[model samples]
Target: MIIAFWVSLFIILYTFIGYGFVLFLLIKIKRLFYTPASFDANLEFPSVTILVAAYNEEDIVDAKVENTLRLDYPQEKKQIIFVTDGSTDSTTEKLNRFNDVLVLHEDSRAGKMAAIKRAMPFVEGEILIFTDANTFLNDEAIKELVKHYRNHKVGAVAGEKRIFVDQTADASSAGEGFYWKYESLLKKWDYELYSNVGAAGELFSIRTRLYENVESDTIIDDHMIAMRIAEKRYIIAYEPKAYAMETASANTAEELKRKIRIAAGGIQSIFRLKKLQIPLIIRYLHFNTSVIVC
Candidate 1:
């Protein structure tokens, strides 16, 4: 019983804190021996398609469009596509007003993965970027994400997600904000060490040609999409400079629900992404057990 208690205590501490320390130390040692490759400054930017999936988000559809338009990418090389599969609101109407943006909508209420699948055929860019309809991206987001594509091994690039919490924020909001801040740090180390386990939906990009169609019922489409590419032995690079900003959940209850959903998705993804799971023996042999999920 004493040995079991000690083992359980170690697991809990390692899950919450010890792993971060180990990761930091591993990264420090790695940096001493490894140097990142440099890219040519004269290389031209590749054509990019910024895909946004919106469902009944009329309030922020226009703002999202404006934000996308404001991104610092070559106008001629960038394509903006918004997919509203089941939006009954003015989301489709508002998006229609943007002559520079392409709007795809269907009355049937298919899930987000379904909407993305429908938008796949229309993607005309060498690089495909995915962002949430409600989050606002920094102007350099597209530029930062696409730059990593110059490295042939980088199959996907994940941008940071920032939560905005003002002074009046409740415990949930502040906690959420702090959580992401730590997550951002872990993702940085994860990329530097090898590759991130998964990418968040707030903002992430992949090579158009490498895109694989996931199941329509995918619970965490973004995570699945990125991990599938990772399973191909390609790197999913993380860029802290290119971030998506959004408000925290409305309340503690909502925050809890969001976390629970994510936890469930993580379990689902682990079973589906069998290739990413290293056997206990292998991990023990390598002394590497830290897995960073974004």
Candidate 2:
């Protein structure tokens, strides 16, 4: 009876207080995210390289290219590179027509990390932004992300990832939407309180100097790369204005598979980066909550 009572009490304490701690941090963060800065539109835009990983993304490749070319930043200041791995379809074929975009195609599908590794040598920029072929960024995303580099202390910047809600919605869509909404809220606060624990590849930037090639089989390479930089004490800022839009994962079961894969990878990531997972030491409630969803 005593043990059972203690267990119930413990669950209650964690459910209420633990969640409250996250909320408290988020409240403090909202003030930070909204704080204005002296960022200038006329400021010199440094050269940037945007890397997109495409694996069988033929249907969306054209849209991705068109959107990247339309980024509000000056063309002379940035480059877009599409890395296609094991794209046994029209993805490579579609990329061939774009002279402005550099396309790297490999026959073997070694996964996203491998494609990124092959493309890293070709990147000629002070900063590199990693994005997915499935997501589309705001026109001002590059401009908004680059302005924070004026501080120099900021090593990486994450953007808001919005899931476009449509009329033919389903539970998977709702689940995915709810996940990112909760995620975006947490990210807004996480960066405000301190640095965001990691950056989502949907839209995130990092200094070229800090760029390190992760393992070929890396399940959550984005988190590993971003957090590795964070462990070095560099600030990973979050900008809500710089957003990326994408649809739900076709359906909930697909989203579930994605979530499960992420959760499994997250378990590996935590063990590898365990030194940084000390509760309250590093902002991980949102991250752990994400893991639980899978």
Candidate 3:
């Protein structure tokens, strides 16, 4: 009983706090003998396609389109696509109002991954960015994400997800914001140590050629897509400067529901990705941290 108790306590502590401290120490030690690579501003940028999947998000479609247009990437090299499969709202209509954006809509309500797969054939850019319809990205997001691909080994780059919480926010909102802040820090450390375990759907870009078709029913397609690339011995870089910002859930119940779904997905991913043969420490960290967070 004592042994079990001690082991359980160790896991809980390691999952929440000890891992971050360990990562910090490991990074400090690594920096002593290793020089991190720097991004070259003069390198020619590749063509990029920003793909957003929307479902009945008519109210925020216009804002998202405007935000995408305001991004700093070269207009000639950038392509914007909004997939509104199964949307019964004006999301498709509003997206159509933007001449610069391509709107793909179908009467069927396929899942998010299905929608992404449907839009894959039309992706003309060398880099494919997946983001939510409601989240807004920073102006330099595309530039920051694509710069890492200059490294041939980098298969994908994950942007940070920031939650907007005001002073009047409730406990759930504040907690969600704090959680993402901590998550962003962990991702930074993870990349420094080696590579990020997975990417968030809010804002992440991948080499179009490296993208494999994820299962159509994937609950968390972003994580799976990134992990599949990692399984191919490619690096998943994390860039904090490129971020997606969105509001917290409306209430505690909604937050709980979201987390529950994520937790379920994490469990499913564990079983599906059991073939991943990365370093044991990284695998452990990824699994435990995901379970704890959800």
Candidate 4:
């Protein structure tokens, strides 16, 4: 019983705090001998497909469209697509009005993962960016994400997710925002040491060819997609400058619901990606870290 008690306590502490501390030290030590590759601004930017999945998002659709259209990237090289697979509102209609945006909608209501899969075949860009409809991107987001792809070793790039909190917010908002801030720190260190565990759904980009079709019922498509690339021995680069700004969940109840779904998806992904736990030391270490937080 005493031994078990000590084990449990150790795991609790390590999982919550020690892991981050160790990762921080490891990253600092790694930088002593390692230098990240540089990007060539003169290189021709690759084509990008900004894919958005929306369901009953009529209220924010117009703003989202405007925000995406005004992004700081070459318009000629970007293909904007909004998939409203399960929407029964004016979302499809609103999106259709934008001639430059491709709207894919169907009366049937499938999950977000299914919606993304349905639109995958139509993507014509070398880089595929996945983002939530409600979140707004910084102007330099696409540029930052695509620039990392210049490194052949990088298969995916995860943009930071920033939560806006004001004085009017409650404890839930503060806590959630603080949590993402901590997550961003860990991601930065993870990138320095190795690669980010997974990509946040708010904003992440992947190489078109590296995208593997996940299960239609997958709950966390973004995490699964980015991790899949990591499994292929490719790095998921983290870019702090490229961010998706979003508000915290409406309340504690909503925040709890979101976390539960993510936890469930993490468990599901752990089982599905067991093969990534090969005997390789570095691979096993990274996979272990992913399981704890992803």
Predicted structure with the largest TM-score when compared to the true one: 3
What lDDT tens digits, residue by residue, belong to model 4 across residues 22-116? 88788778878888667887888999999999999999999999999999999999999999987888999999999999999899988898888
**lDDT top scorer:** 3
Q: Candidate 4: global Cα-lDDT? A: 0.85
Roughly what TM-score does model 4 have, to 2 decimal places? 0.92
Model 1, residue pairs in steric clash = none
For candidate 1, the 10 contiguous residues with the lowest summed lDDT are: 285-294
Candidate 1: regions farther than 4 A off: 1-4, 166-168, 279-294
TM-score of each: 0.92, 0.88, 0.95, 0.92
Worst 10-residue lDDT window for candidate 2 reads 280-289
Off by over 4 Å in 3: 166-168, 277-294
**Per-model C-alpha RMSD:** 3.3, 3.1, 1.7, 2.7
Clashing pairs in 4: none
Where is model 3 poorest over a 10-residue stretch in terms of lDDT? 277-286
- Model 2, span 1-294: residue lDDT tens: 999999766655554356547667667667666774578777788899999999998898999999999998888978889988788999999999999999898798887888888998999989899889989999999988888888778888888889987667676787677767767776776676665676777999999999866666778888888877777778889988999998877777677688788777777777777668784333454455444543
- Give the whole-model CA lDDT for all candidates, comma-separated: 0.84, 0.80, 0.87, 0.85
Alpha carbon deviation, residue 74, candidate 2 (Å): 0.3
